[model samples]
Target: MRYFFLLVLLGGLGWCPAQAQAPAARHTFALGPTDFLLDGKPLQMISGELHYPRIPREAWRARLKMAKAMGLNTIGTYVFWNVHEPQPGQYDFTGNNDVAAFVRMAQQEGLWVILRPSPYVCAEWEFGGYPYWLQNVPGLKVRSQEPQYVAAYKRYIEAVGKQLAPLQVGHGGPVLMVQVENEYGSYGSDKQYLALNKKLFEDAGFDGVLYTCDPVADVAKGHLPGLLPAVNGTDKPAEIRRLVRANHDGQGPYYVAEWYPAWFDWWGAPHHTVPAARYTPGLDSVLRAGMSINMYMFHGGTTRAFLNGANYKGDTSHYEPQVSSYDYDAPLDEAGNPTAKFRAFRAVIAKYRPAGAAPLPPVPAAKPSAALPALQLTQYASLLGHLPAPVASPTPLTFEQLKQAYGFVLYRATVPGGRSEVLKINDLRDYAVVLVNGRRVGTLDRRLRQDSLRLALPAGPVQLDILVENLGRINFGAYLLQNNKGITRRVLLGGREVTGWRMYGLPFAQAPTVAAGSPTPAAASGPVLRAATFTLAQPIDTYLDMRQWGKGVVWLNGHNLGRYWAIGPQQTLYVPAEWLRKGTNDIKVLELLRPEQTALRFLDHPILSELSGPQP
Candidate 1:
């Protein structure tokens, strides 16, 4: 006992048993013939997908802890290229976009990682995670074997490799595997392009096992000769396994990379939810068959700012934008609270545990939220009153041509031989508000397939203004090629084309400071900037109810709270308490259709499911 106490004292004084013991052997993770082998032993991966940019930076550890509690040994996440490389050369990995830190946090919570670093990750992210600057490159065709596209892709992958390559499993980190271009077979069947993606990953120092994930039907087309193919879907694991095995010549170890426990919600559509019973049994069946699975989203976070992507199928298609809240009805809700799905999954995972694995960790406590009283917005500034010197152009330019990524663009011109007939805007990308002589006339929406509006022209010369909002860029399908916002072609009025225009590109990249040199708004006519200052005794997270306002964006204390439309579905913008202050907080809204009675309200909860349009 005296010797033991002396040894303990010596250990605290920099002497320890570890120094006397032999070094632990290095563990290697590899793809086995039938299962994932860690140091020549079989391992089963139960993963949950999430994005680092979606959740708050401070809440990353808590979210990972929640995943660990739900029997998730792995966390899958996609590295958004656009968020890291907002500009062509300039890169940012700080704040919420710090993906390395996110991976390290998962490791700290005793979890492994699966990385999906597709430069064109189509996760309903803006432009499918492709940087908008790619559109500016001459003769660049994305997701193809085009030289320009491949060159830019190589540069991006190299940059990512610099930050993450050293964190792979072999380097004493938790990154188990990295995926190539996401579900490429669903988009195209070009083997050469897919091969190039694999080569790029290898060149970027990703030496671990690489895989391609695709829907069951597209597995054959998307699967490469040497790389493993992983399936994605929710139903019929037996058939999906057969399909994946068939693609790999009857391989044994099947992996489902994206098992959708629930779907995502778009604006004007009902929030998506799947019953826990429907998937719990299906998940059990998959595990019983010895196939690894990764839930598409164990916890879906909010798609804040103008980063939400849209979907446009074709010319005769409905243009739908994704809602701000991406609570995909997963095991963990957007607020990181465990649900029925979480408990169901835990039960299923417990039944499928390996021979000697650790017990599931305890669930973390839910984050508390507060509801504040509505604060009235009084000060106002019109968007028209805040136009910078315009870019001169003969023909109307798209958002890409104007070097603008997201938000609104104002096009102004003088009517030639002014006549009040029909005004047609050729291929208006998404939504447009028309005004003649600074007065609200009519709106043309892509959702309703409306491109022409009746213009009552004044005699001699009339000023024409069209404020176009890039609702979102298509994150899926071939429509990604045609995602440029703003008026694509020339505007025609009564068969006479309007020429000689000044374009004001309103990216709103920065926070709203009172639009320079603008008169106070008296009557709401055109798009206006509404401002208000509210006092809070204590800072608390609250949702800003935007039901009273029309289509627009909001910023609170320099933080972009995302877009809001009276278009039902999403009526409240989430404002985090971190963006608020103890004494005073500033709120600004750029409403396209200015309200008669301008005021701002706070809601206790989000209005993500109050659908008013046709059910999707």
Candidate 2:
């Protein structure tokens, strides 16, 4: 392990970056009964949250630049517990997940950083950002005060803090505040855990302000002593007052931790939008009123890979199946372009900027349409071609059984006397199609949490196939980052964990070899790779329409763009310009619900589109 020394912000105004950094100058940032001050001057914060791991690293500067140009003073970001400590002790402080670099970049751009390090960040991320690995850790109950759970959680905090504390204003970094364990009030009423979190942060060398944010409903249970308390659920004057009253009943600066310009959608939920015209002005009113606010995602990027989220409304489980594109229809659209929301926000901020600072820079010139030639992908392999050696007892297996890494996993079994009626996959992880007689007759998605699906069968010896893909691991709260693939448990006919199983690995199917066809159509019903070609003269950011296709995954060249579902809400997959190459680019779509090529085109930007049918 590389030893990291404590970096201190010389005067206490900046972060203590490892590589010689500046610190924030010590001053009383005032929030008196009627006014707020920073360094004894009025302090007004207009913040927006954006995850470092969500957007491609290459685009970080561009996004931050966009935020600054729009007049944002603080950049709020959640440090995913799962991503930082994917496996115990083994930390990954590199690439798109480089939170330290992200903070540094924000500082370089002259913006304050709000680090929302959550062992439980509920950002619509998979399993709430808890790694699947934790599920099997003996008596681990997440988000609790369990010693074992806290041990694991503590390790993550230590690991994450090692990378962050040095970046706090005390260390000469731009980070102004650190948010402890996201939305704790909504998850539980354990104020003790909140205190523990505060201690952990201080132990890690974060001298900047510490805070806890939750919906007002959680204030009594989530607030910490001597720390700033902020509410996340409201934007209006009344709701703000209510949240404040519900908490300390005395507020000078309330942080709108998550001011949603729009909402999220499960597979079948209707797409939603806040209509910039309406919300932009509302946001302005809050700013004009001199409030502290942070948009959950100023630049809602992609959830790429298995990091998408799900909802458990009551007892039913529905995976929202965030498209690769996270364009939450914020001030900035998915394409990194300024929307009317942006222009409106620019106008709003123009009215409140500090007197000495320059006006927001002119919006960057917009790029024109650029086109390129189509490139063909030549090499690939089908899932069936490479089957892992057989396992014992043939019953169904979960992603854990095969010990297979994430992406796609295949489950194979022979019907005793051929096909059986009312065949069902007990708990299909997201999407899976049952293939009997070498043909697909039914598909099931855990997003719908359905079992007992009707299917057709053939006679004599028959093969039953179930191909499952790992949508992005939940990347947010309690279960922050869930990974692993396959059944994880068992498949049942009539509530029996089907046995006599044969499994195959599907990780190699990506960039499949195109034997002798146009690689544009789905191959039968089992998992199939649908490839399409598009040209790009000058690269531009875009979101791919995933609704036309069934449930599965997408790839550009070969990079995973996360999971997709035909279910409504998230319809487009974000394809960042950074991921695009000049000339012919290849696109691959993996449909787990029976193989069929679904023609795909660019949706231009990310926004939840309306569902096709009425709710059940």
Candidate 3:
């Protein structure tokens, strides 16, 4: 036994004795002058982005295994601040938010990890991954050096460090590199803010190599003096090397941080897709030039609930709210099954495997899918009937003022002896349904740059109500600064400011309860809650088809399945089998617009390609 222990210590034995087992092997990952060095040797990292919150916890391993089969050596992910700290100081790290477990899973699957724990990750997420409570902070400026912003950011980062700092490669874990603020230069050129971000990460105990990623044009502006610079949205091998070399000390450890194989979809647009042949050549060239690359999304699971974001190009005319399905036309489908693009990219990757490296794992088979018969939603409840007590206010309150994060808010006021005049809501964030005496007359949509509707008010003080929907906050560009939901400004009638409002906050943090077999009230012309129950012999992954339903949200077995609109593109919500039970399952729909048919079906596959002409 002693001889065997000696042999193990000297590395002469195949296995170590139980009592003589050494600590886990620690590694050094650094940026070399000409390459990324892993323990003093060059490593060509082939990584893919996958978010934990977007995928079900039970499906994380299966997705990671699929990534491995596609010949990925590294997995990149963003730590969404909003997902962890939904409230001001409250933090959650268990279940899908368990990022440490996710990193460990990558290591267990024989893959390295690159951590992008930026406070502002603009991956088309709501408010760029900022907690909605940030809007409530007095004199706080996001993505800036404001003292309050910095202090809050510090607390959040330190909390994250406690969860992941020990998982760095230096501590015998899989995380190799940590990213600073994501794509900072595209938004602003504040060197102090960038420096502050770097310092915060270092202070939080991320001792590994730190890096910054930006578009090729912003590389020089975003990168710090010591941190490595990476580029996104470009795959030209020569241009990548040039940008990195120009930004750094004239050397060549080039990395493409975000190579876009395809694009994302927004509401009212056709589903975006890129032919596999269009970008496969560029991918081949990047690999052939010995450059490292990370696909923007190997699989873009789903952007569940009100967490989806919108895009604004400095004006409301360009406001495009993103759809529920974030599939990204990636190598893997929304269900984590490999697509044709996966095979095409894998073939190119197989050609670049390091000499004598282990063979790629066999591609996993797709999970089985099941279909359900049409579910009739017989029971209904009116949203107005189930109102919580309102906050009496002289003027309309924004979502932040009411301490509400997402969903709808209702504003009620009485207009005395009104005439035929235009009803305008100043600074309407996204969408609003205007009602006069319990009748929905018209809607004000920010997407079309609309803020007013001509109304013929009845005589003798009619009750006026405006239900505003926070479609999503702008996730990118300068518009993000002014992304407060609800009525930011006062309502105007006939060019005069109207006051005296009662605001009802409807954050919908939990699914609203409606009594079973309740009759549809006579005044149920507005948003209604419809419910149905069905049984499944064996629950399999399926898509909830909402083509017949108008705009609203859905829930399956109490899980928020996400929003759906008749306005094309995303007609189905991907429901993971893990969220379903083998017995009876309850499904509910909150239809903002009345459904053409009060029934829904389950599809074995997703239907994200259909387009509707115009919304009602």
Candidate 4:
């Protein structure tokens, strides 16, 4: 073996052979003026992108195996800040969020790691992987050097660095390269910000090669002086070389940091899929020309919980929210199964892998899934019944304003002189279900930009309730500045402003107690919380079919199964067998829209690709 000597050195250093031997630490990774050097030998990153948070903790190794089987020597992943630190200063690296463990797992699987710890990772994830509490940091502007924002950024970097810096190749670990702020060129050309990012990495103990990645057009503006500039895209070799040359005086080791095998999907848009034939030849050309490439998503996993982000270019752009299933139509499906693209790409990678490199391990078998019997969610609880104490406010408060990150917010106003009028919520965020005195009125959707709904107000005193659902924060582009969900502006009724409001914060950070055993008073209110139990003889991965339901979120055994809508592309929720028990398991669904539901079901397969005619 070429790295046999390196294995002896590592073994002498008291490291376990089984975990650290295969991907021999032959050389300290370094960046040359033209190419990357491993123990002074030229190296290229034949990597596949995978996110740790997307895949379940139990499946990390299996996914790594699948990645290696696809002929990748390196695995690239973004460390999501929000997943690690949901709250400011409260970091969580345990369980699925344990990135260090993931890196070690990669090492064990004989793979190198490319760490992209973007405190703000715009992976169509909620708030670009930034903690939602960052919005509450008085006068904070993100992706910039605003003092509060920059301070928070540094702290996060330090925190993540503490966990991962020790695993760098320089420290005898598998991590070869670390990326600076992700796609900074697409956001801004702040040289100082880019330089600060590099400095932070150094200060935090990341001594290996640091690189900055941007789309081909943005490389010049995004790259810093000392850091390597890696272009991202599927551009032709000539164009890619031209772009790199224009940015830096380099003739060798071009790196496509993000080669898009496929694209991400917005809720309303059709599921994106690129034919394998469309890029295999390009892959061959790049490898032949000695360029390193990392597929954006080697395997796109589900966007669990309410972690999906939205997209809005600006005021004029359409507000499109991302669905829960982030199956980016990649080589590996969301379920971690190989696809046609996987087979084709494996063939291409096999052809291009370094001479005499070990043959890839056998492809892993697909995980078994089951179609469960229709589950009857007999128990019920309305959101109004489960709300915490009201935050009495004269005007409606945004989620950030109320120190709330996600879930729903209830804005209730007592209209004394009630009449038939046009009720306008000047800036309604996402989705809102209007209620007049606990009676359903009409629904206002942000996708349709419907802020006002006709109200037939009773002549007497009326309780006007506007329950707003914070779908997700805008993850990318210019609109990220205005990501605060809920009612941003004033509430108007019949051209007259409605004041005196009682706002209820339903972060739903924890699952609420519902009326169990028997149905709760015949389901006569807003946002019913339905409960059901299912028994499994032998637990296996199954999908909770949400076609029969309306819009809501599901919790299996108190674990958030993520948001579901009848306006599907994604009709079923992936319930991992790891989350199931051998006996009985409880399912709780907090459906927001349709309260007329009595039963829920599970399917053997996922329905993530069906486009419902045209989205409203």
The prediction achieving the highest TM-score against the true structure is 3
Clashing pairs in 1: none
The alpha-carbon lDDT assigned to residue 142 of candidate 4 equals 92
TM-score of each candidate?
0.92, 0.85, 0.95, 0.94
Stronger candidate by lDDT (1 vs 4): 4
Superposition error at 325 for model 4 (Å): 0.4
- Residue 385, candidate 1: Cα error in Å is 0.5
State the TM-score for model 1.
Answer: 0.92
TM-score of 2: 0.85
Error of 4 at 504 (Å): 1.4
Candidate no. 4 TM-score: 0.94
lDDT of 2 by residue, 1-616 (tens): 1223333334265544543533355444434553445666667788877888888899888889888988998999887766776666778899888989999899888888888886777677766777666766766778777888888887788888888887876566777778887777776787787788788777777767787887767766777756667777676766775665456546645667777777655556655567777776778777777778888778877677766665544334355455555677777766577778788777877888877887788787543332223233323334454356655545666665555435666677876544456766654665676677556677666666666676555567667777677654554433332434567556766455567877765654345444436443344445555666666677876666666566667788777786676655666666777888888777776666535545565655454675653333
lDDT of 3: 0.88
Task: Work out how many backbone clashes candidate 4 has.
Answer: 0
Clashes of 1: 0
- Which of 1 and 3 is the better model by lDDT? 3
Which ranges of candidate 4 are over 4 A from the true structure? 1-26, 520-525, 613-616
Per-residue lDDT for 265-338 in model 4, tens only? 77666777789999899888888777788998998898888889988886677798999887888999888889
Q: Tens digits of per-residue lDDT for model 3 on 419-467?
A: 8989988889878888888777888878777888999998889889898
All candidates' lDDT scores?
0.84, 0.68, 0.88, 0.85
* Range of the 10 consecutive residues with the lowest summed lDDT in candidate 3: 13-22
* Candidate 3: residue 348 Cα off by (Å): 0.6
Cα misplacement distance, residue 167 of candidate 4 (Å): 0.7
